[model samples]
Target: MDTDLGYWIIPLAIIGGAIRVSTPFLFVSLGEALTERSGRINLGLEGTLVFGAMSGYAVAYLTGSPWLGVLAAALCGALFGLVHGVICSLPRVNDIAIGIAMMILGMGLAFYFGKPFVQPVAPDLPAISFGWWSDIPQVRAALEVNVLFLIGAGLAVLLWWMLRATRVGLTLRVVGDSTDAARAMGLRPALIRTCATAVGGAFAGVGGAYLSLYYPGSWNEGISSGQGLMAVALVIFARWNPLACFGAALLFGGAGALGPVLQSVGVSEGYYLFFAAPYVLTLGVLIATSSPKRAMTGAPGELSITK
Candidate 1:
């Protein structure tokens, strides 16, 4: 009976982990997708994520409201993005260099200020049980999902529609594809990109909030683990489409869940290495995206990486 249960347990655990793990990816990748769509790259999102996690956790602990924590995280992320945008707008400023600096700064700030809350218990985000109808424990566990994940899913579709049908979306595309053209039309690319970057930063902050207040449910320096950096490649893989970002995030999330799922079924030997699956998958995505055979059709024209 135990051996028979293994087959059911493995797939169910992986599926559950994928759902749990993918929430952060979904939010971060959407944020990156939006920023890239505006022709700005925020590599410092890792910093934004970590710092947001800290701020969110701290606020939640103090306010006793998990929702407020998410709000705080998003606001802080927007502030970080605003700073990155302002600096990058300066003449002769390199976006990549500024991004790296922001990344380091965000992490340092999070680590330093977060030291006080390391041992304190904070409120956690709530979950909705889609599996309440099921009597089986595995099915119930696998079906239980977070509210943020639902929001992220709906947000992906909404963002996709906004990008396709909205006037602001058209303006963003115009600016991203050709800043010179935007200048000719009297549009300010700098202002537009700055605002978009801030919005993107807010999205990343929510992803951080999820990490600290939901799944792992704790404030820690190690929570992010380069998920922010990997989100850049994820945006590329999704061809900068918000809806595609959802699928790509789930793929990466599923990769991340592989190790623990395997270990749960008695495959503990070296299962720790399976934790690297997401990073390895990210490398593979980068390689596939960079292939000469791929036309790179949907990439923003003004992005330095694409150029």
Candidate 2:
């Protein structure tokens, strides 16, 4: 085995990893951020993510436009979130259990609809080129970043600003911190949570769309590998901050890329272990940050999971 010291490769790989892995987390984390901010936790986002992948791919294949597919996916996701939010708002229903049920339902629906799209060639999202300043082939290749990365970054900043500087953001935080307080302030907690869940679902759907339309086109049962679940953990690790979520997502993405990077270097002895890196990192972070005593401290007070 040739173990060459290609210093540039490491940086390139990091950049590529950030670009490739952050999209899904970006959407999921941001969506969760919104939901959590509104005093709710939609664990069914895993299903939303997968179902969105299928919906997006199928729509894009039929419409010949990846953007439309993304829109359709978002709509589908919103509908799913609506279902979750409405059901969870019931007097005796539990959000966590309902979320789990929704996840299974979403996955089943995706498989059922996605069966025909298993081998179809759908239109993919376009990438932004940043290789103009580079003359070297490696540099050029490294600079070939996806547009979704930029969009995710921009969204982080936008969300951060909105959360801190906007009245709507204030309302969301208030709702999360104390639904009763929000009611005292004459705000409708249920409405806010419902809207937040819908928005979050849309984001997850878009993320799923990215997986199907860009990173790996076409549809199959195994297109996703728990990226959706990891994104939920990432939201807590990120402390409900969209900007922090972006950084956390990049880290998770790097962990995910380790397997392929090692494989590229002809190291395959521990490929399966490498594949587990992202989940392990997620678990570690959850343990480090989670505490029963401080559970509702960091989490929104009204959130069912935190309670």
Candidate 3:
């Protein structure tokens, strides 16, 4: 490939990789967004992501149905979230500390039960080839978008609308903003937060399914790549907006794809550094958006203390 042509290919490759790699980030960030919107934070989503990957892959391999695997993953993730929610609801309990404990519990359970699935080849999720119109192999391959990506994107829109336009959304916001206010309105804050956490966990689980059954298309202990933790920062960067989560996910995905794009174009001189693109991007975004005097402009009041 010509040197100049390689430069052009880099952008296209990153675009393609962004769409594919952003799915998990989108789902996880959305999950965290919902949780935070309801006045809770689940840092353990990293463990949830890994556990979901194991469960989804194991189920898919055993059942020969990838969709079923996705379902299983969602259910398992919800269970983890439920546990976290219940524990955090207790008086004087610290949500962040509990989240870390859950993370450890989730990882331990996954590693122990996931041993049987390390070598199994699960059924892979299907993709839609939007790039079929292109005759170029690279274009066609790059445009093969996953169905889950479309689903996640649609959910983002729906979530954004729901949070801003519905009664349920209002209730969640009230509860997140002030537990006393929720009580004044005759709402059960604990119940609401628990439900929101579970829903968030479900989304994270689906993201995990996408990882093990779609892109990387395999289940292993290392499947997550810290995407779960990065999601917390991404949610902060997105200001807890579901729609913004999608856009941030794409940006992070593009950063992650940088290394592969360079290698694809015969530029492997600093391949490893490129792999750190997503992490570097996260750090930079955090530093740029953070403020000492106030929270990021749109942060949930409950989490503002972290500022």
Question: Candidate 2: deviation at residue 93, Å?
Answer: 1.3
Model 2 residue runs over 4 Å out of place are: 1-7, 266-268, 283-297
Poorest stretch of ten by lDDT in candidate 2: 1-10
Clashes of each: 0, 0, 0
Where model 3 places Cα greater than 4 Å from the true spot, the runs are: 1-5, 291-293, 304-307
Clashing pairs in 3: none
Listed in order, each prediction's TM-score against the native is: 0.94, 0.92, 0.94
lDDT of 1 by residue, 1-307 (tens): 1234656777777678789988888888898888888898999898999999999999999999999999999999999999999998899898889889999999999999999999999989999899989778778878889999999999999999988999898888888889999999999999999999999999999999999999899998888878888887788888899998998888888777788778777788987579887777777876765767765879999998887
The runs of at least 3 residues in candidate 1 whose Cα sits more than 4 Å from the true structure, single-residue gaps closed, are 1-4, 268-273, 282-294
True-structure lDDT of candidate 1: 0.89
Error (Å) of candidate 2 at residue 298 is: 3.8
Name the better of 2 and 3 by TM-score.
3
Model 2 residue 125 CA deviation (Å) reads 0.5
lDDT per residue, candidate 3, 100-155, as tens digits?
A: 89888887888889898888788899999998686667777789999999999999
